[model samples]
Target: MYCNHCGANQPDHAVFCSQCGAKLQTQSESTVPSEQEIDKEQTPVDYLDQLRSDQSSNHTDSEPTLPIANKPIHRAEPASSTVSVPPSGSPPYRSTSPARHLTWIIPTVLLLGIAGTLFWWYQHQQDINVQVTQLHQEASQLALKGQYEPALAKITQATTLRPTYAVLTKDQTMIETANRIHTKLETVSSNLKQNQLQPAEKSLITLQKALDTRKESIFEQEKTLANRNQDLLAVLKVKKELDQLDTIDALAYKLDEVDRLNNQEAKEVHQLIINKIITISMKNAEKLLQQNDFSQATAAVKAGLQYSSKDEKLLSLQKRITSEKEAFELAEKQRIERAIQQAEEEDLKNRTAGVELLNVDTQLNEYGDIEIYGEVKNVATKPIYSITVYYSGYDAAGNYLFSSSASVEPYDLEPGATGSYSAYEYDWYEEVTVQIDNITWYLE
Candidate 1:
């Protein structure tokens, strides 16, 4: 046998070519034996088969066996017509089958996939780098615009993307500037929270200076932003003072506002001082009034009224003083009137007396005796006249007689005049007594 692929000769009856490892085909002509060879090779099995063969088995026509030398041999094709095999020890040629090509395809696809993945990663890196640059630029712009919080956010993101960007020197400067600005803002914020207007203003000024310095150093346009922030802070402080003013008393509020204003800023400090003075004056006036010093109290209140003329309390105080003064004047007037009335009543109950007239005439003097002659007039007309003239007084019921006296003439003359005449001589009575009617007159 010969291999079709390799043309290697094989032994007869071989099922395969040994040299090329090809399968061999069986041939019937090669298996047939010649009749003489078969007769020479007959065995006892052929005689038994002839004797015991049934009619059916014999009729099946078993042909006589041929000798091996008479059998027709099947011959292989010529070597020139067979496929040639490679030389010994040479490796078999690989088939160009799709299944075999799939091995290279898998590796090629895997390589292509790896390349694509690397390319995608590179592109992603580039995109991220671009984004980082854009974010850094945006952050710088925002910082220049004085938007520190947002600028800080962008700067933080950019730093995360590119921890050490080559051009980050400027970005780093910007970040530092933003941090300084934030610190200044926080300082101002704390001062404002404490309601320290002066300190807060100072902080704002410092912040502006720092911002200006940063702008100049970095060649950024942040002065305008700094100025705007300062203006905003100023406005906020003014508004806060105004709001505080709303809740405080008028004098205190005005004083606080005046103090808050800058020295260069014109305000009504004088007016506030005057208002405070007026308030003090009013309080003093009230104190004086409470102490019952109306004269000084009125003066003080009048001074206060000069500033706050329409104050109800001042007016009420004035009214009260006027009422009190009027009451005092009325009481004094009543006291004087009562005193005059009492004096008049006392004068009406008093008693008064006076003498009308008396006349004395010719008389003789005697040893141990004296003559008396006189006319006595009655002055009181409220009673009747009783006549009794005595030089040495002796009555009609005389307990002792030293002399005698009789009325020569007597008359009752209304309340204007009444006359009587009498004479008496006596030594014992050196004085004379004359009684006209019921009125008595004594002459010494």
Candidate 2:
């Protein structure tokens, strides 16, 4: 008997091959034979060759045949052929069959192939995990920097690496919200700087609402900054209102408002206001000073100093105004004195113009008074209504002794008419000389 699969020789009673472990075909289920039934004289036949002889004997030209791993000894296409038989009593041909080797090799190859595939799958999964984790870290870093758009991009790209990862969707939503808030915050800051109070206020309100809805602790700092900027926006609103006022009162009121603000931006704006006040004050006061308006100029300097009391330019301007005022007063006083003196000299010339002194004599009278007599004639075309004589008496040494004035006897002297004039001085002089000094009259 033989094994049908590997063609191994076996004992006559053996029901299975010893070499290939293939089951042997037997007449019936039976026990192993005794030594009397052992066919030691009989030779074994190769089961593979016997299978081919049977296949050839049953071969038909029209019947389809299946191929085994190894080619069969007979072609199914040939319908008839003489079956070849090995010589009797020669030890039955024993050879290793390809099926015998393939029995274990196929299973080993399938196992190795399965192990390699699993190892490759595991390594690929590890790489995807590392890449996804790296993307998550980069996205987190970008988010911390307020780079919300880039963070979103990085996290969204992580979805490409691991599309089934549901965590990335949540991260996308978070970064999107942060990006919107960041944009609004920037808008608020820009509006504040440009003095757009309404827009900035609106943006702040929106930001506050968003933060409140989220109630996220991460946005705490942004909320704090928004609140702080809101205060500045209020101050800027006041400043804007103040800027529209053209009156002196409004400007002064703005100076008063400066004390109320405590923010750094507000302080900066307040400083600008102070500078504007000083600049405007200096210009106004300087113009007034040029016009010699000392009172108004002083008021202008005071208006500037009311806000910034220690400003150097204002202080210097105040001193300049004071000095200018003093100099102006002194100059005014001298001018008035000179004007009065000129008026007096002009009046004197007008009064003495038409009077002519014909003769002037002085004598010591018995009463011890010095007497001066002068004859005055009208020298102009108009008549003098009343005549008066003025005299200056001189001593022999030519020094002035006294002045005497007296009305002439004929009060209504016609023009070109002679009139007698006399005047007496209480003191007497020896060898006196008198001259008519001036005559005063009203024109008729």
Candidate 3:
């Protein structure tokens, strides 16, 4: 048969074209069927014989025919159809072959990859930890060297890099220890700077003791850090006090330091005091000189000069005192001499006056033999004069001996004053008196 679509020749019994794979239509045969058509309706064995006969007959034709009846068809079969039907008791079909059973390999590979990654991470972490530890160690060393700021920076970096590293514990401890040592050193340094050696030394000792205790503790590093802070605080306090000190206070502090150090500077401090004292003394002396209390002022100047012997003020004061004392002595001597001369003149005046008599004798007979005498003299122009005479005599103790009187009227006297009167002599001392005008002279 010819296919109308492509004009390809096909067998008469073909339902489709072999080359183009197109469908063909069959025409109906009338009345008696053709022998080929009758043969197609045979039993299974007769059909097979027919196919063999057709194949043998078609071999002589020149046209290419479908070799469907000559060779067995080897078309690919479906997996389900090719599967062997196992006996009822046998195990079911397994698609996986023994050689293809690699279920364990994927999980094993994954686990190995995970392990490798974990190992790499662990090694990296270990390197980081080592670096952190080294950094911490360096910080500790800096702290030991009293480089607090730098050490703190290094420790801070170390902590940041490996905050929980196992090796960091020891490093942290060392860092803390270094901090404590730094603090103690700082306290000592501050004390020295402030000139408060005693207190500073005490604080330093306390810090050292604390450090010793901290060293025994598990958290020694932390303790050391605390101690360092304390030291800083102490130093800061001292610095503040020092800053506030004025000139006088600073000088006093220096003097105290000199005393503490037993240094030669002590002499300088003492000299300053001496100068001040001398100045004050001189000022006081000047005031005294103003008040004209030269004695006291001179003494003050002398005392002041003991401290400063060559002081001009003191020398001036001494000169003033010497001048004043000489003037005073001269005046005093002149006054004493005037007083003595006046006294002597008065004595001479008293001696030049004549003595006056109180009474003249009157009675005579009752006593034994006696002698009486009297004389008068003019005190003004004449040297000698004559006047009434009176006499009296008595025994050793004034017992009446003899008495007599003689009146010489209108007696004459010389120019210079002279007078003589005699009393009667008795056994012993006797009283005698003369009355001239109203005046009386006594002779004894």
Candidate 4:
């Protein structure tokens, strides 16, 4: 028979063709082989094993011979038309069926897909690491700047990017530490403003422990708190001194002593001193007003007003001083006028009738002032309103030193009424002369 693969002539009973290494066609296969006839041929696995055995045998030694079966070989079925047999005398032909190639292609493609997937996952992990590192750096910088909230956000992002124990623990520690320091700083600031010195100091101490004191702003805050505490202490000391002081001068001196502190709190203390000074000055002014020392009272009020011109208490005190002074002056003027009128009436009575000094005397008192005293007798027909005794001082040699006058008591002296007259001169004189110079007489 002719070989079906290469059309070469072969023995009619040969199971495989020698020229093309293909199975020979038999009459039964050519007509239509039954299932039993098709099963008699090698399966695809056996075919592939034969190919591998032939390849190994070819490289080591002379080609190994195939096991030729004694039964008649059969032609492939029509369904295997796509299979192509190798040429005559070629090495054992491997299968060329489409299904055979698909097996290799599927495994190759699956292996390449797995390798590509692993490479992509590695790259993604690297990117996450880089992102997490960047977040950590940003968080650290923000914390240094005292931006605690933003820093915590960055740490949170980093932890989310890489949820490992290291990342989570680092984030928790960083955020808590920064937030704690920030809270303490806020507390310290509030306490300072409210004048809670002891609490502020304690908070400041806690903040300092967490912060780097070398920074200028942090150091400045620490110094400011310390100085504020010191200033308050000094103010309290001054207040204690002020409480012990009894005089306006001493209070004023104490106020001046605390003027060296110049902070905002110190400014408040200074204002307190000013208010106290105003209060003391006004109170003293009121006391002096009670004593009718209008000049001294005015001086006190004016002194207080100089420090605080717009103070209502000082203004009111000034108004009182002015009113009282004017009233005092008016009353004094009326009294002096009445005394002068009486003196004129007495002078007229003395001239019309007759008045004389019964005696004149002079002596030095303990105060080194001279006292010249005498008596007068009223000889007028009606009562006399008043009388004046004029006196002149002289040295032992009789040279006039000074001259003055005195009024007699019991100004409304009746006819034959005698009244006493006395006068004091602040001088060291040896002798004094007395005479009835004027008289004031009035009818009741």
Candidate 5:
């Protein structure tokens, strides 16, 4: 039997636990009657009467014989007197406390439960690792296929399972990077397709910069593709700008800005641009010439000449503008000369009608000198205050004569006013005539 208090092994008849000094049983309670004593006993009533008679007889003694205490029990072999072996036919003593019976049983059940829990936990952890690994593999495959969204979802799930796992972490980063790159590429492609070159070029440049830090095989190829797309975008931009050009100056400016002429197509397009510019400039120049805007026409032609100085149409237009300008100048000069001539004729007529001589006489004076006199009048319906009279003397043969001049008496004349003039020439004698030469007069 096990000691109740300390669970130490002990004999069944032990009065006190050997390990903890706990009482196991009283001496009287531990003792069992011998089967021979039971057989020799009278009937049951007689035995009870005899056990009472003995107890009364023993109590009657002043000190009843102190019953000797039972001896300590042995571990394996014990004397029949020390051990409390029940009589051969008597039933064995059995414990009635449930707690006593369950002491060993409960621990065994607890141990089994703990072991089962540990095994299940290990299996669960293994399953989790496998699932995470499988998800990582799937994500890698999807990323390779360029299905980044689904791949990102898978990678996220795997990473959640093992946040500190190295392979999963790397895969997550790779997938995220690939997804970003794919997004940028799509944006660039869309912009390119829509002719949004500047934005597309910007995105491509950003993508190139991002790829510059990586050594991935695909990233390198993408970098190359980005560069090619950048070139293509530049070309397309140039071509678009060229297409929108409606004038030679604008096209020339755009051409100067473009740097991709080495491309065969760009070179051809450049040639076409030159031709178009020259043609448009020549046409504009022609229009300007027709409008008599010679300066603007010359400017337009020179603009075309800057692109193709030897182009036939431009040169022809330039020559035409020059010819037209020269012709125009000549016509203008002729017009001015005609105007001047007409003005001169009208002035001569006006002067002629302005003054006249009337009542003029010329004779030889007493000294045989020629004397001339006249009344000068402003015949222009205006007053006259001043006039000059001219006199000439000649022989009766009317040969060339000496001429002299004299002024009227006053210096100023009113409209239609008359002024007198007399001149005596003492040099020659003979016929004399008085004639009005010019009148200085003012209108009334």
Candidate 6:
């Protein structure tokens, strides 16, 4: 038999539990199905009779047992005599309580439930990690495409799923800042397009300040846009100034700044600037050329060529100027030569009329002026337009002291006609010797 309290093995007739030492109950003979006990349902009289029979047979010191709830139980005293044994084949007493069975059952159930809960928690965390990872990948892809809002949305979802991740938190902040800057850049661009210089400048300055002060890293595209807008502003200003100007000097002066931008707009502006310079230069040079101001024309062409050396119009104008200037110089040379030849031929044809200095005299007048007097003979047959005798005066030592000139009376003279002339030198020199050096006359 198993002990009821401790589940320890015991003999069939054990009066007390061996492991716990508690009083053990015997099985009621009537309770077991048997042929001998016919009064299975005992009346009150029979129960009383049996109790009196047990009381008369034994004198016991054991305490009376209390009745179970709503059931009457007969108590048996400890036997001093030998107890009767049941049949040898009868089953041993092995009753146990439901409460005892629940000890192991409840603990087993609790252990199983705890294990299930732990396993479920682990799987839940894994699922969360996977979700967060997928969200991060989506965010990254969107961010790469410059879709910051959707990317931020994904990151925000991830943040909600895994709020403890500091990396996610940082990513959220960075993306937020980048998106703000991007919006600001768009505003700046719109302002620039509308020619709102003040607002555009303010936006750019604010954006740059944010970039400078922000701890998170900004995107490269945002930085590039900012810088591009700055250059665009400067380029627009240059183009504005250039458009207002009509001179090559002003337009060409901004070419350097235009080149520095090196963007599409700047390249277009640069072409325009060069074209303006070339056009104005060509026109100015052409005007100067028409005026026969070759020097200034050459200067204008040179200025234009500085901007565009390969310009076809400027080159053509330059070539024309060269050709025209050369032709003019050649023509002038030929005319001068013709004039000299004609004058010489006339002089040779009229050589028969010779000039003579008859009654030539030089002396100091009483007014302290040195006087030179002479009579000129027109030794030519043709009448001269005007004749003047030029002479140099020297001292008695033959050193040049002064020079004098005089015109003969009766401006035109016939062949062999005589004319008298007198010249005075104001500066005093000792003992002057007058020598006639050259005479000039015009033959018209």
Q: Pick the candidate with the highest TM-score.
A: 6
The regions of model 2 sitting more than 4 angstroms off are 1-101, 186-196, 212-235, 244-268, 276-310, 321-444
| Cα lDDT, all candidates | 0.55, 0.73, 0.53, 0.68, 0.69, 0.76
Candidate 6, residues 1-444, lDDT tens digits: the string is 655456476687888777666565455532333433433424213334454444434433453322332365555453432234446445544324344455457787999999999999999999999999999889877876679999999999999999999989988888887898899899888888887777888788878876776544347678778889988887778877876889876786788888888578888889989999998998899999998899999999999999899988889999999999999889989998998897687577565234656666889877777888888877675776477788998877889987768998878877778888888887584568889876766554
Which window of ten consecutive residues has the lowest lDDT sum in model 1? 346-355
Better of 5 and 6 by lDDT: 6
Candidate 5 local lDDT, 1-444, one digit each (tens): 544445466786776777556666433443345555545545322332343444455343453332321233233432242323345433334333334445556787899999999999999999999998899889877777778798889989988989988878877787788778877887787787688887898788788888889886435545655766676676678787676789766787767655444455456667778888888887888889889999999998888888888898888888889999999989989999998997677466446667766777877877878777777766664454446665555566766567677888777666666778887778565565444444454433
| lDDT ranking from best candidate downward | 6, 2, 5, 4, 1, 3
Clashing pairs in 5: 382-415, 382-416, 383-414, 383-415, 383-416, 384-413, 384-414, 385-412, 385-413
Clashes of 6: 3
Provide TM-scores for the models. Answer: 0.29, 0.44, 0.27, 0.41, 0.36, 0.57
- Comparing 3 and 6 by lDDT, which wins? 6
Please write out the lDDT profile of model 1 over residues 286-387, one tens digit for every residue: 788777677887887787676568877777878887777677679878988887785555333211221343754534355544455565544442432444
Listing every candidate in turn, what is its Cα RMSD in Å to the true structure after a full C-alpha superposition? 25.2, 14.6, 24.7, 17.4, 18.1, 14.2
Predicted structure 4, TM vs. truth: 0.41
Runs in model 1 with CA error above 4 Å?
Answer: 1-107, 119-157, 163-204, 208-279, 284-444
Clashing pairs in 2: none
Per-residue lDDT of 253 in model 5: 72
* RMSD score of candidate 3 (Å): 24.7
Q: Which whole-number lDDT from 0 to 100 does residue 441 have in model 2?
A: 73
Residue-level lDDT for 213 in candidate 4 = 46
Clashes of 2: 0
lDDT of 5: 0.69
- The CA lDDT at 2 in model 5 is 49
